[model samples]
Target: MKNILRTAGVLAVASASVLTGVTAAQAAPSCSTARVCLYDDYWFTGTPRSFGWVTYNVGVDSNDKGSSLVIGPATDPASPYVYFYVDNNFAGNNVVFRAGNASNDLRGLYMTPTRNWDDEITSVWG
Candidate 1:
């Protein structure tokens, strides 16, 4: 009985550790080089949206639906940052996201009364 209990305890600890690790990994964001990724929810959770090289007026689908984003290292040396706007047609409050800098959560960067930009982005460019 004593040996059996010890084995069960070890298995329980191992399982807990594995679960914890998975949760931590899911809470972080991973960005690919030369691309921009936006997460619908903070801490890199929820829907993942990607963008490429272009001057864009974020379409209706992704409009006002970004909570956090990742700006990968600029593959083009001349363009080292991405500019985002709070309104359509690149109008309203704007923010710059430099290459090699990003966040898992937007609450620190973009915020509202509730969740950071829960659904309030309109345009982007790099």
Candidate 2:
């Protein structure tokens, strides 16, 4: 799902066949290259769940719960965007982020006119 997007702070989204969830209270991981990491809270704090290429549902533990995001360089330069969705099965409103981007706070990125990307993501892909 595509919506009106904000240009500042350079936010990120998600997608992956392989995703890793870290403890929410734990500090964020390095995030590495060719990966997208979604944080439980703003400023890359709290829990962090990282992902690679392919689509994902974000699981029950992390669905609609992301507050920030970090993206690594794309493995495939031709497909360098990460996608975050508002609905399951890769449906509903969505945000697409470029590789190597990071957002300290997803709250500032608009997913819809009145709603921001923070805590509104249900699915993801790159």
Query: What are the TM-scores, per candidate, against the unseen true structure?
Result: 0.66, 0.72
lDDT of 1 by residue, 35-80 (tens): 7788888767678888763445667778888877788778887889
- Model 2, 1-126: lDDT tens digits are 144354221232221212433233333345777777888888787888876656468788888888988888888889888888899878988888888777778889997689998898887787
Residue pairs that clash (backbone atoms under 3 angstroms), model 1:
64-119
Best model per lDDT: 2
Lowest lDDT sum, 10 consecutive residues, model 1, at: 109-118
Off by over 4 Å in 2: 1-29
User: CA RMSD for every model?
Assistant: 6.3, 14.8
Q: Tell me, by TM-score, which candidate is best.
A: 2
Q: Clashing residue pairs, candidate 2?
A: 1-94, 14-125, 15-124, 15-125, 24-46, 24-47
Which 10 consecutive residues of model 2 have the lowest summed lDDT?
9-18
Candidate 1 global TM-score = 0.66
